[model samples]
Target chain A: MTARLGPLFEACGAQHRAALIGYLPAGYPTVDGSRALLQAMLDGGCDLVEVGVPYSDPVLDGPTIQAAAEAALRGGVRLRDVLSVVESIAAAGGRAVVMTYWNPVHRYGVDAFARDLAAAGGLGVITPDLIPDEAQDWLIAAQKHDLDRIFLVAPSSTDQRLASTAAATCGFLYASSLMGVTGARDVVSSTAAELVGRAREYAPGLPIGVGLGVRNSAQAAEVASFADAVIVGSAFVTAAGAGTSGVRALAADLATGVRRPAPQPA
Target chain B: MVGIQPVESSTAVPDARGHFGRYGGRFVPEALIKALDQLTEVYTEARSDPEFTARLNGLLADYTGRPSPITEVPRLSEHAGGALIVLKREDLNHTGSHKINNVLGQALLTQRMGKPRVIAETGAGQHGVATATACALLGLQCVVYMGEVDTERQALNVARMRLLGAEVIPVKTGSRTLKDAINEALRDWVTNVDTTHYLLGTVAGPHPFPVMVRDFHRVIGLEARAQMLARYGRLPDAVAACVGGGSNAIGIFHPFIDDPSVRLVGFEAAGDGVDTGRHAATLFAGEPGMLHGALSYLLQDSDGQTIETHSISAGLDYPGVGPEHSWLKDTGRAEYRPITDAQAMDAFQLLSRTEGIIPAIESAHAVAGALTLGAELGPGALLLVNLSGRGDKDVDTAVKWFDLLEDK
Candidate 1:
């Protein structure tokens, strides 16, 4: 699994395009429904998919994702159900990762979670709340299981923190485009480019995926100009609410946007 | 009765990574790590600085009224089968609760950190009112996030906060309760880490918060111990307090931890009853899980999803308890019991009628537990209960519960 992310990014780089990453809470609305939605996202051109493990309290999520998570939880989705969703996505040849808060993983036992997630064919995990400094248990577990550990870098992160976080991260650096919770915005903050640039200085050649506000195709194209991956969550969650077809259509549109040539310097 | 003696050590809690023996830690986003570090550094410095301690103590004395008296409730104890009951009068504080102690301390820390604004999350509104009062006194901008449902149930407190110049935001998100409000406050802190302070109200969040808030309220036990000794020449056999997020319990229990003869007890709200699955008895009926940045005993289902808790008292209707309390329970240093809503309400009215002291429904849980404990002890047992807050805010709830407002 640790060997999967590099090739995914390199392949996108060869195509002169940014990888399109879509997010959906596992078992949202229903487990089967969510699995099908994730497959639709991949079918519609998403290079990678993030299956969110719904937590009771998601501090970093906005209302859209929070609602989705609540619905998933209401549907009785557990960690095993999440791993099953990832398994289905992997069996279908879709590159999938589990994005979750740290507590669920901690409660599930870090080593057990890593072993099970790897067994389910998960490429890596995106821990929105777990920082590298306090993630020693997870660090050791992920390394032991040969699973990728993706860490988030916020706009507020100091240089020292960014370097340490990047050093510990396995797959890619998740650069939050803004300082606020995860949600869509009409305008992607200019801070995303600055953050990506800063992360690059500390972790040269590492893939930086910009998330937290990239909503539309235009915003995706704008972020794709500098970021190695355009990670959109709330927008996809909003679309997934309508149907799997909606998720597929949005993924296709976002995929095209990421591939569009960066606007010639005006 | 055991004689009161000064506890040997003051700060043994929260090892380097903030774990109270595998319970607490900085399980937060990367964005908040720097803020937590800065807070820990400032708190460490403030803890040792004479000027800081003096200023905080002065404010605690002059503004909030420290050294709250302990009252022996013999009339109430008569109903407890001959046992003597003493009440730690935290309810007599200026802001009407023990929460003021923690808010004032954090507000001072906010000023020391040079932050101009503070954000908090509230459930029953006592913490919100206390935070608003402190922020007003210190001239700091205050924003409080409350669950939309809580805002409606605790309308007076919402108005009180607004009157004190704090902005009250009704969060209409998940569960629409304390947990959601905390989520919003954390988001705000992460977004405005440079200029704002998240003045957490309870001893449940990540490191520094649990330890810092506990230190602020430890004065409760310290003062109570001295007062008990000065008055009765001995320590009470048992100390009890209501546990929502376990602030008041920890406050009164910390100083007595070394007193081997003194039994520390915490009463959690059992909304209907633990058997009915509608209760907030996290330590009693809950399993270990993580929420709001700390791994603690939480009311969760088989899938690790947090179960919505119920209590007549909005303050105690939370699914999680403080991590330190979890550590205490596991170490056999403390015992936690569940009190049903009916039992707590019965004690609420009983205290009012017998002693003319209107206890908050939250505190009444402890009062109810003390009654059972007193009866079990048979006779001559001395129990000190922390009257955590006044019942003024719960009058409407009481009136409705007993149908006092019905045309009579």
Candidate 2:
């Protein structure tokens, strides 16, 4: 339930740090290999693991993540494969969430998908394309199944939408830092700070997680200063291509960045 | 067939969330939702404004040549066992295809919205050329994304688009085909939603696009229906058109959908044959899946990854059909058939020689289907077919296929 995710963020908040969330496609390279990589991320101190459900058309993904998803899809990854990964993460005592575009879930059946994901011990799902206004079926299904429905709030979203999206989201709100698709950037956008600030006005109790271009430790630390969670996706996916050791190294580095101490006042 | 009533109202479609029965919806990223919503609102207002309609109608009439005549081909009819075959000459439109109809309307909308740049994705480059021409006329910056393979196969169209002052981007990802081009265009739209308008070319995509594009081309059916009535004092026994994304077919079919007596037939390109597992026959062989922001019938593997589709005609070489076509198929309001590449080519050459009219390979699929239907209905049966485009773009491919250049 939503209460389960709160403790993880609360634990990080107690340490004066943001939660380190690492993402990797469910069947990257191979399904079993991806599970090993996910375990490495958790071992390296990622607070949460987001297992991507590879889709045919990932409109919101940048080239790096898109290539990884295409490879996973080519390798014959399906909803069942993703669920198996979730089960593995849960068994290892790591909180796992499914990040996917809405179509695959729609095709898989909403209520059935929610029930299966819950049974597999998935905390929730992050539907990148599903907005609060059009999320009635998902809302009902998530409520009935007691699963968290994470919604995305963009820089382009209006205040009314921000409020609605924050209100509807059961888990933390996903705040897209940039206007563009997911990728690593040299500098975090100035708008990300503004978006996080605005999200606070709308959803006071909800934690805001910033994603889309958080690459290195420096960028992660910068975002960690103003956000509750630093989501590193493409960087981890790129590291995943190298092997499990590469994933562990990147995850540890990012985890350290989220825990970096604030500057002492002069 | 199910006993669903034939759709009588044209505006009944797409509700608020853009569902044509169980088919269309906004299955795009959150980044593009605002743009889609803005487009839906602007299009709703633009459709009702007399000034907007006047400008669009004037341009359609004076610039693109509206009311393209219906030409009855008795000579070609001979091959069909004496069925009276009439062609709606959409090929006569400016840019040599029915693609211009949808672009012109969207381009007008772009200008009204104060957007200075327009982006589009194309398969065979007809839609790209059409978009380029509209952008050029409207003094807006134009960019077209096309598959790398399509650029090579349709080099002349690539040249035409560039000549029209549009930038042609060859996409090299994910099979390097229409589907990839669409993904790239969508990415561009999400990044540049403020200054750019994505001029979609067919009756597909997320919400208002399917309804808006279909309305823009509905003139094809309206004009053809009136002309057919005026000429023969009644509607044709059947109306047929090729189905790529189903724009041309929907355009010609919508006006006649209410008339149950008039059968609506759509011909899909079966690259080899449907049974061979290499074709673009989405309605015939595909199951419901999501692609390009719409949940419709698509050629996908068991895991739901889109499968590569094949067709000799680049325009018809797509794995997904428009959501409306899927709805029509499910409702049994329209019937769809598969026309193999060989059958389409046979009809292409037969029409060119018999009637001195070279049809686009995409349209030839419809012609091929009409021939079979004509034979089944026997003599005195009247058939109306939408000649969607000219074959000038396919001449090179034709020469290679028939080995016409080998003699030289």
The lDDT of each candidate is 0.90, 0.90
State the DockQ, from 0 to 1, for candidate 1: 0.68
Pairs that collide, model 1: none
lDDT of 1 by residue, A172-264 (tens): 999999888988999889888899999999998789999998878888898899989999999999998779889989999999899985673
In angstroms and one decimal each, the interface RMSD of every candidate reads 1.5, 1.6
CAPRI tier for the interface of model 1: medium
Q: lDDT of model 2 at residue B358? A: 100
Q: Write the per-residue lDDT of candidate 1 for residues B117-168, one digit (tens) a residue.
A: 9999999999999999999999999999999989988888999999999999
Restricting to chain A, the TM-score for each candidate equals: 0.97, 0.97
- How far out, in Å, is residue B89 in model 1? 0.5
